[model samples]
Target: MSNTAAVRIDDTPAPAFSAAPMKIVVVGHVDHGKSTLVGRILNETGALPEGKVEYLREVCDKRGMPFEWAFVMDALQAERDQGITIDTAQIRFATQFRPYVIIDAPGHKEFLKNMITGAASAEAAVLVIDADEGVQEQSRRHGYLLHLLGLRQIAVAVNKMDLVNYDQTRFEVVKAEIVAYLNSIGVEPTYVIPVAARGGVNISENSAETAWYKGPSVLGALDLFEQARPATDLALRFPVQDVYKFDQRRIIAGRIESGRLKVGDTLVFAPTGKSARVASIESWGVQSLSAVSAGAGQSVGITLDEQIFIERGQVASLAEAAPAVSHTLKARLFWLGRNALKVGSRYKLKLATAEYAVEVIAIERVIDVEDLANHPGAEVGRNAVAEVVFRSRTPIAHDSFLDNPRLGRFVVVEDYDIVGGGVIAEAGGIHQAHKSANITEVAHKVDFETRALANGHRGGVVWLTGLSGAGKSTIAMEVERQLFLKGWQVMVLDGDNVRHGLCSDLGFSPEDRAENIRRVGEVAHLFAQAGMLVITAFISPYRADRDRVRTIHPDVFHEIHVAAELDECEKRDPKGLYKKARAGQIPEFTGISAPYEAPEAPELALVTTGKPADESVAELVRYLEANFSLTARNQTESWGF
Candidate 1:
């Protein structure tokens, strides 16, 4: 029992102090006395309040049934009649060394789902086996699950030794067999004790019936299990659970899974890459606390200095130490479905607060739960384990299980039920974070200045911007023809020509238009890098969209705005687009009923309403030659800020 006395309060309140708090799960085969062992622990530790056990015993007697220790956990009438544990039950208790929340996991085949849910939250486990029953199927299966669930701290309790006449040989034989199975799954028990939970022998103290055993008692071995690594020492990971908007402030709330978060700290939400600064740390009842920093499993609410569109399923991490971004991952999963998990089958992967559509790409190997041996298989059978690869339809922020368990685990849902679970072994895909990192660096195999000087002109993008039918395309084509005639390398990327091929799949929505402009900017940047002058003509209406294009080629991006009144452009409807737009045949037609955000600043603006196409082209050429050196030189000069 703990040094602190158990206080009985009318309305139960949390304990003042109880050492380190830990979650321990008890699992084994059905009828293996798992609940009996739990009941014995609660009784021996003095955790049960006065009259509680007597009350239960009286109830059992009134029902004309034998009062078993399992009755303490199997409180439901169905469980008592069925004589099986159907769900996980939790009880709070404490030993001399620490406080515990012991979860009793169900052992029936049909209730393995409940077992998994209970085991996943456990930090340590106890595997129970009946001495007379020896090793059962669930003995091996539950042991394997403890390994798969990443529970390294475990102990084995050989219960009902009194039923075997307290024979040492019988206990050793059962322990050896079970130990071999656990070893196969790469788990080593902290202690293996021979005990009779019903008889209350070898539980809190060594029993004379087991004089041959020299190990610590059950209570002693439990105290030896170490606590999990401290989350405050690891990288910060806070998964947003909800966004609450109270009055003028928006608060992001969640549990801090790892590390500490402080006010004024900059945070980046993963997958979306949105950034924010912590404005205040909020606690429910604390009025004077200015800062909040919590370790693993502590709930926190924070308001940001600047509001950004963020929601649940986005992991908040440090900007420099963000999680991996990918849609493809290799994982090791345990299949618990009644139906086999097959290749090409679609399922829902629930990780943290996110749910994604996933498909099994490959079943690398199926593990024999009984022997822990690998074998080739086309699918993962019911209650089987396998190393599989899955492909998500969209990218998710994650870390390898070995690196961060909080962000690495996921459960698979089939037909609206959780049927499988896994942990990421590796993050790999086309849009990997490593590949994205490489994009930020300037790749200079052939120097940019050298290529420009050899081409006799500085490579740059000539972005011609105006409404349709404003002579922008005509002037762009004429300039391209004139440049080619001057023995200069030039290319024209007309918006219509690009839409026919490069952007054939895009539509005319606002989102699609932004994407179209982004693609054009990328293509133009590549052409300029190759020491060629690229001219682009489009009705790029949004100022933010144009600014995004400018950042792509900041050194040489020139915006030539072609000015024409709406009346003039409508009168010169070259492609009859205005007529169709006015006829209501087009939706989101820029500058016609739809909004058009014109540029606030332009490098050059030309009045093309009454000007000839040749005159506009000449002015463009003069501007380009006066600002850029078109003659070949041995050295190149940097231009623009």
Candidate 2:
């Protein structure tokens, strides 16, 4: 939002003209003439270079393509090589009403994630639906998403009218269908224009093809309307993307959301509760005399009046209405990860400029994003709209997506992968999401030293891997009770027991089993975060999957092999699941239909042939005490459990 590099998109400083350029993006389904519409606009307005259109035509002839409209977004080599609009692209055009900076986005399902980079910053959206195609899936979806993203002003350009014989009736049919869907999704397009972008009808100039319809042209509708920004003009909020400091002067770089900032004004930092005064505002080496007041669309760097500790994540806000900061968060999630979102999917939650480890606590309910009706018992999966509860490893200052988008939206990343993106509807919930690296009381702040005293030496996951009726849970619980008696702060996450509460509705598919282990791993990690030794007993049969669980907790996880042969485990038949599996009652019964992969490397292996729980508990205690200590708090109220 910096004007020094690019002129402001909308607002003008004086009455003569608006300095903020009118930037808009046109997005919809493929083959709907989005790029052609842009090309037509540029051609009619003379925005493109004299030879650019001819070059495109020549390129299309060489490639033997019929000059599809989507080719116009080939600003980068990667885009042309991929033969798809891999990212949101921008181009400029002018109408009698206003000049526009248009962003053309991809419509393919595979590239919807890429669409976000374009739509996230736009003031309004123009959905191009094919007049013949009516409201396609992406059309309805884009409309719904536009509503969700809080883009208020909308205008629909029903293109391809020429294909429908330029019939106003055909245009009306598509218009009604789209209007119905948009209204159902809580969006009312200000105007719907029937035009053929390729034929040059009703683009920048009026078209005579649709004489039956007396509506405005595409450019007419846009020119007639004015830009409407987010309401309330809330306090100035900007998320620091990066911090640059040299020669003892600090500069924080970010985009402004609303309101303004001036020099010598008091500012507060989020989640950290720190405050400082702005000494100066500088951008492009120009020092703003009024640094305390910076309007929206302005990106400025400010120097503190007093020397203060700052970080990339910390939010600078007005002294009033401090941003919420807490580890526990409850919000609606739109799961877009390659795998279904379930309990124990731990990843980094990137809120504002800060990223922290996060876990899915409870899936309140999964709803179909398209239908809006709640799916009473839906488990996590791709493209699901669920009201899920999650917690972050540390407190982050953020506002609700409904209230302030400047600091409300966030994306979750797993290592280098962007798995999920969500809005913070609310934060600082009933449970605390704080954690410590170690197990016992200690003098140090690092997790290693505190863990040295908590569990006795070092902490790790005791993964009990076996088939059903292998007595993993029974032994795990018994050992936990003995450790509790010996003054060990131990937590037991039983695989089946957890399902009865946290994961009651999940089924027993291969994917479901992996989700179960993942959830258990995350819960055990929380217990470890609380400075307690956690014992996890599940039939986590897959060695690679079990290894995946260990990676989640790192040094705090230990994979324990509960070696009970299939024949011996079936004889025990404690749960009768084995008998049912053999009788064809269950499809995914381990030791019958499903295969259980044993661990190649186990920190502790207990042969499950009637080994007394007491002996197993003693052996676990000795091993854990030899390596890790039970960690404890060094000071009162250290935010460590």
What would the per-residue lDDT of candidate 2 be over residues 1-641, giving only the tens digit for each residue?
A: 12222222222221222345565667888778787777787787888888887888898799787775555666776766666566777887765445678888777767767776677767777889998887777786667666656676788999998889998888888999888888876678877888898888888656678777666667666655566544337756655666788689888777666556678766776544456788877777655443446766787788887765667777777666556665456665556678777775677888766777667766777755456566646367765556676655445567777667777777778668887666665644211122232556555355644553544533345667777776678778877777778677777888878989887867775545655666787777766775677788788755545765675555667777777778888898988888888889998677676567777778888776777656766776677665454343332222223
Q: Give the TM-score of candidate 1.
A: 0.67
**Can you write out model 1's per-residue Cα lDDT over 323-359, one digit (the tens) per residue?**
8766566887879888999987889998888888777
CA lDDT of each candidate? 0.81, 0.69
What RMSD does model 1 have?
Answer: 13.3
- Full-model lDDT, candidate 1: 0.81
Error of 1 at 523 (Å): 12
